[model samples]
Target: MSLLRILVRVALVALLSMAPLSVAAHEVQPAISDVELSEDTVTITLTTAIEPILAGVDLEGIEDTNDSPLSDRVDALRALPPETLAAELAERWPEIAERITLRAGDTRVTPVLVDVTIPEVGDTEIRRDSTLLLTAPLPDDGSPVTFGWDAELGGLIVRQGDDAQGYNAFLTSGAVTDPMPRTGVAEQNLGDVIVTYVVSGFDHIIPKGLDHILFVLGLFFYSLAWRPLLWQVSAFTVAHTATLALATLGIVQPTMWIVEALIAASIVWVGVENIWSGGRRDIGWGRIAVVFGFGLLHGLGFASVLSEFGLGQYFIASLISFNVGVEIGQLTVIAAAFLLLGLPFGSKPWYRRAVAIPGSLVIAAIASYWVLNRIGWAGDIPYLA
Candidate 1:
């Protein structure tokens, strides 16, 4: 057998071995909630995929819902009709509400289910989200209230209504927002908001962002040399920072569907260029320009995620902090790549043929699958979809 064929077979086998892990990673989406406090009641509208939760799966700590032992149950729940799923949640409200907590002063308040909205059954390949409304009665004394969810429910986006200046923050499991009043809750302090958003931004990149990880790896594989890699990454950072700010400020609004498709396309472009360039030592202005343009598309993608956590007061701080965190994440990736490949073998002649080309091929293949899958053509192909 030819050397290239052998390498291809080895890559395929490695991917197959990691298939279960990949599926699990892709299935988990963080739970997001919008909180509204009024004189009489505190309402939380949570949008999440309820199938795994209903299937007796413990989503806490698991990267993918499928990684749970309750995969069979999750599949069963997915097969259920929207009405049926809603009914099941209604019947299990007591159990479900226990995982979500709302408190007034020192007392834990039990929430009554206001409504449940589930998407109609569609292709099993697409995960459907259900909107849940839970309301808790406020204390007549007008005492401050705290809101949060169990660690098992994942992260929550806590936002306040009734305040002209809007209050919002992203909270991880077990983290509670500052005590909010029935009216006019103060915005979080600038330093605290900056720190909190920095953590949020870092969290999104290190573990949750597989696509972004692959894209960064594509850049690294282009050339492990410091000059070329730094140039590309710098251009990327500037471009993404621009779009992220613009999109968050609501000046440039684009549909997430388009942004996602473009993001995938960007990955393909980087990977293809790596192969075409053959790990050239010199960096070109054209490549830097391309990276900058792709960075804009990726910034839009980042904006989509940040949009879920409404930019409350301290908008500039939050925006800059998030951008700083993303840069940190990118640098971390580059550092790891250097440790693994560049440190020892970067100067070797075979490094380009053995590492850069093969890695780029794999990246290009995965990204091509993403492009097709994003456009809805892959259809139930486990890895591709």
Candidate 2:
């Protein structure tokens, strides 16, 4: 076989492997748990997609539960009646509780399953959330408590109720939060808050966010030349930062469906532009302006993710940290592109034809499909359906 054909075959296999990752990106939803500490009892209300967890699908680092080998079992569980599902969860509570830990001071507190609320069978296409209530008795002395799940359960959004300050955080993989009783203990300093949020933001872009990665790749392929790339990236960063702050502050509230559709459209636009521009160094101001506008849409998309873990006590810290992390992630993508493609072959005569054009075309095609899928035409495609 010709070298080009061999390379194409390998690329096709890689893309197919990444296809599940893309689907999983859109299905990313963290489980939320509301922890309320009362005088006598500690009540934890967790709202999560139960079927996947019950099916032994690892929620952490998984893009989509449907892509799991155990998806068939999850589907069967999803089809069960509410009562039956509740009963199954009841039977499974002991094992599940063992994986989740709650501690009052130095001593472990055992949580008893109080109630389970299962959603009625809805559109099987969408995973439905179920609520689980587990309670543990509070110590008479009223000491501080720490609670977290096993790393295997994935990330959990813990919201603190019954406190005036209302502290909340998105914890991942066995990471526990500061002590819960907010009165005596010191709150997280600004540095701690910043570090936590920064990691969250970077994770969203680097490994977890396939759509965002494609968008960044679209910008990267537009031009490897420093001047144009810097302008476009700076504009995008500034624009998204502005909108991310606004959306997080609740000033600009746009529906996610609209933001997501526009984000996909932005990817398609950039990819198509790269092809049309033909590796030109003279990218116009108009293109930069469009990029900035699309950056605003992308910011709203970022806001949707941040909304999952509401700005707790440290709103400014979290917002700024997350945006900084996103910028870092974006720069990392550009740097990787540079090292991989531009460093070696950017000056080559056939760089445009061999790399730029083909890459942009592929990005455009995938993003166009994403646009259609996000806008509800996914069911029309046989494989996607």
- Of the candidates shown, which would achieve the greatest lDDT relative to the real structure? 2
Error of 1 at 143 (Å): 0.5
Model 2 clash pairs are: 24-63
- Backbone collisions counted per model: 1, 1
Write model 1 residue lDDT over 1-385, tens digit each, in one string: 6675465446434422332213234567777777778877888888888987778777667777656788877877888898888888999989978876688888789988889899888755446788989888887878788888777777677877622256886777678888988787745888888887887677677776667777888889898767888898989999999999898878999988778878888988998999998486779999999999999998998888788777777677778888888878777867776666667667867777877787778777777777777777776676455
Q: Highest TM-score: which candidate?
A: 1
- If scored against the real structure, what TM-score would every candidate get? 0.91, 0.89
What is the Å distance of residue 363 in model 2 from its true position?
1.3
Which runs in model 1 stand beyond 4 Å of their true positions? 1-26, 162-164, 380-385
Candidate 2 lDDT over 174-201, as tens digits, reads 8887788824322667777789788889
lDDT of 2 at 252: 96
**Residue 314 in candidate 1, Cα distance off native in Å:** 1.0
Candidate 2 segments whose C-alpha is farther than 4 A from its true place: 1-22, 26-28, 120-126, 161-164, 182-186
